[model samples]
Target chain A: MKKYGSLIGQLVIGALIGFFGMLAVLDGDFRIDLSPYAYPGNLIILAAAAVLAVFSAYRYVSIRNLAKQDLSGEEEDAAEGRMYRHYADASLASTLAILFSLASMSLSLLTTQPLWLLIFGLVLIAFSFIISGILPGLMKNMYPERDLPSITDKKYAEKLLNVSDDGEKHIMLGGLYKTHITMNSLLLGAIVLLLFYSIASDSSQLFSIFIIVGILAITNTQYQFSIRNK
Target chain B: MKTRLKELRARLGINQTELAKRAKISRQTVSLIERGEFMPSLLIATKIARVFKEPVEEIFQFEEEELK
Candidate 1:
């Protein structure tokens, strides 16, 4: 849920790239060259792109399942807990998809492989815009009825206030907040490091941003594991 | 933590939604409380107890093993 903002932002960026890529394709500037570039550099780029694409697909599926699970089940708190867990997973999947699309773009730029570039760019757009942005809500719509009571109701607010004042509930809520903050900080640090590395490297600005996003995605997974194992 | 929320609610002949409304909490929160899956704050416990016209201690009991 926390990741939605960033996911939307990324989706916008990906959509923009796809929009331009589509223009290039329609203009016939992007062509499918069946003949391989046959250079070692081109080969490496293609290989990397392939790997990232595979991972992106895998992550998207994982997120879809997690989202489904988060919305289902009997226990309200347990469902909420699942939501917290899936937020990180969904963020990671979005990042991977973005990275895969970017990798394809990079490969295309390096080898003049318009097909790979356009294909991956479109995939990135779909993953970001559709998968990360709107899929969860759509999936949640499948379960139109929610058993959990709305917090906005006057009576519910009183109950919440009552529950909130209790020692154990207070402690539990506090711990969840603390953990969320810690994970955010850790992810922020990783982004900072990626920024520095990007500046030090020869990659394009877009590539650097994509790499930072990839790191941010990884941090979510790491945070989940750290909490679970601890 | 152990609670007699379900038993009390049953005795009162009220559903979770009604009790939750009266208690000023979400239906899910009330359900969770009844299931003993969530621990409420002192105020909430007292409020719930008040709704049932019983002492908080009468509705909720703490187990020593649970504390450990």
Candidate 2:
């Protein structure tokens, strides 16, 4: 059943792309007047996109299973956990879109074939991942994946931490909430920049940001947050 | 990062269950807090302080010198 389901999904994806590719060719945009493989680049990307969609979806389910099993009783709010998981999935999808776009761009530039159609197709697929996969997935999550718990009710958390006095409680709470906001806002800011770059027709800018985001994620989560908590 | 929660509880002569009931947190959370493996949130810290009849500052303190 699973096999057939995946097969059907891939077929549908291919058919849709094939139809679009044929339409583009029929409209006559081929620079070299050869449309036999005018959209081979597109076809390849569509196929790759199908595979990635299925793979990421499968991994998401697996991750969800792991989270549930590991935090069986630990999940104080199931909905909140699910929300954060969704955000993580959205972030993952955006990441995949950027990667695939880069791949198609490389193939187009490296080969003698003018893959304008392929470029068009890759852009469409990237948009699909970003809109359908990323946005929807994140809508279900309360927090983005890279952020910490953000000091839920810093006062309560402080109280738990043995912080006394009304004055200090306010500070701890403010600090925690501020940290959460800043961290999330930064990721959001980066996402906005990348989205604008992609729209302005320059996904190349996303390459550096990805690296920067990864480094920040590691440093902030592993070292800064860890040391502070310790 | 080690905490004296267990010793403190012992000094107060309260069992884990009783302490958790007072803190309104799960027994597992209490156990985790006492072990110093997982940090408590502000609310939980306040609850712990209230249980100990002390300011949260006294109940939870940094081991090293203050940041100053």
Candidate 3:
């Protein structure tokens, strides 16, 4: 019970959010309008992008320095562990920064906001792309003994997976299995909600429902095919 | 399965990262094995055993229910 306390809390919160979202979808009068708050929202998004950019840069530099250092004793081993964690953090932060910047740009274009905001978004997108490109190189630095393939390599994913040890593969298997199950369940729930919304509201969500079902079928088929021979 | 990995590493004056390197696995995997959250595969078990110069059963011990 104690072990599942947090999971139960999250499920309850998710249920509440889903209920409210369904209510809003069903209520004809409830419409979402972002026009009024477009400028303020874009500003907040820009702030977030800037913060993430700075954090990713800091992490990148820290990891680079840690990788280059030749420490002895327990510190070397500790540094190795820290370097891996910092690399993951930097990768995530840079990816989020790119996404947030892209969102800001799209919002600005749709709202016909100021040119400066769009320019900032473009600059951020370029910066994040560069950071993303350099991250795989940093991984090579950390594991100089291993012949890690470049990100641009055609078979990078296969090569990378092949390089992983059995334990790492086991962990990936567990995580991917959980993700597959969760995604299927969530997409089914989404399809049900779309069905209800289409029946109750003026807008027909038939296309969206079709797309979700297609996705579900394709993903399940892909999983089955991947494991069929294995 | 519970492992004597942490005990062996302590005796050898090595950290998780070093043990992982010696075993050709990730440090997180070593940490998980020590915490009994993850059970290593046969190959990984043999690798870890080689690193510690011990037999696989001597390092990893499982109860009857776990075996079932």
Candidate 4:
């Protein structure tokens, strides 16, 4: 229970946000206007992107330096492990920055925004793409002995899993199992909420509900098939 | 299962990464084994035993209830 406390809290918060968002959409007067705040918002987003980029660069350089150094001592080996963790964190931050910037660019495109906003969004998107692209290569530098595949490779997932040790596989299995259970539960809850919304608003949620159910069926079937013979 | 992995590594004057490299496993696995968070396979146990020049039984011990 204690282990799942934060997950449960996040789920509740997400559900509440979704509920309010749906309510706003159904109110019939909901409108999103970002023209007024576009300049300042984009500037803030650019600043955030710059900060993340700098942090990722710092981690990359640090890992590179550590990897090149004589890691023969116990302390040096421990430092290498720390670098790996820092690299993972930095990679996650870079991905988040990319996603956030992309979302902001989409908003700019959707709303009545200025030309300069669009250009800024494009530059930010390009910068994000470059950062995300370089991260995997930085990770590879830390493990020069292993032949790590690029993210764009067709067999990257299989190759990566093959390279993982049993303990890492065990951890991955536990995480994936939890994610599967959570996804199924969340999809079921979403169906229930859609049903209520449809009934209350006198609007058909059949399409959305069918899509959700279809996704659930497909994923469950895939999981079952993958392990049925095992 | 409890393991004297840390103790053995210390005796060998090696860190987790060195042990992992010698045992042909991940450093994370070495750490997990030390923390008693994971029960290693016979292959891994043997490998680790080889690294520390000890028997598997000497490195990993099972409690009475765990045996049951």
Best by DockQ: 4
Instruction: List candidate 4 segments past 4 Å from native.
Output: A1-47, A147-153, A181-217
Candidate 1 vs candidate 4, TM-score winner: 4
**Residues A87-126, model 4: lDDT tens digits:** 8877876776676677667767877667776676677667
Which ranges of candidate 2 are over 4 A from the true structure? Answer: A1-53, A60-90, A106-111, A114-124, A131-230, B3-55, B64-68
Interface RMSD of each: 6.8, 10.7, 2.1, 1.7
Clashes of each: 6, 24, 0, 0
TM-score of the A chain in model 1: 0.33
What is the per-residue lDDT of model 2 for residues A82-157, given as tens digits with 9 covering 90 to 100? 5445546645664665566566665566555566645654665666464544343332232232222234344543
Please give, for residues B23-46, the per-residue lDDT of candidate 3 as tens digits: 778777887788778888898999
Interface RMSD of 3: 2.1
Q: How high is the lDDT of residue B8 in model 4?
A: 81
- Displacement of the residue B14 alpha carbon in candidate 3, Å: 2.7
How much does each candidate deviate from the true structure in C-alpha RMSD?
Answer: 15.7, 18.2, 4.9, 5.6
Q: Pick the candidate with the highest lDDT.
A: 3
Which residue pairs collide, candidate 4? Answer: none
Candidates sorted on TM-score, descending: 3, 4, 1, 2
lDDT of 3 by residue, A69-101 (tens): 987657887898799889889988999999999
Q: Candidate 1's error at A54, in angstroms?
A: 11
TM-score of 3: 0.80
Q: Point out where model 3 deviates above 4 Å.
A: A1-31, A181-217
TM-score of 4: 0.75
Q: Would you list the C-alpha lDDT of every candidate in the order shown?
A: 0.59, 0.57, 0.87, 0.79
For model 1, the superposed segments whose C-alpha errors exceed 4 Å read A1-114, A136-230, B4-38, B41-56, B62-68
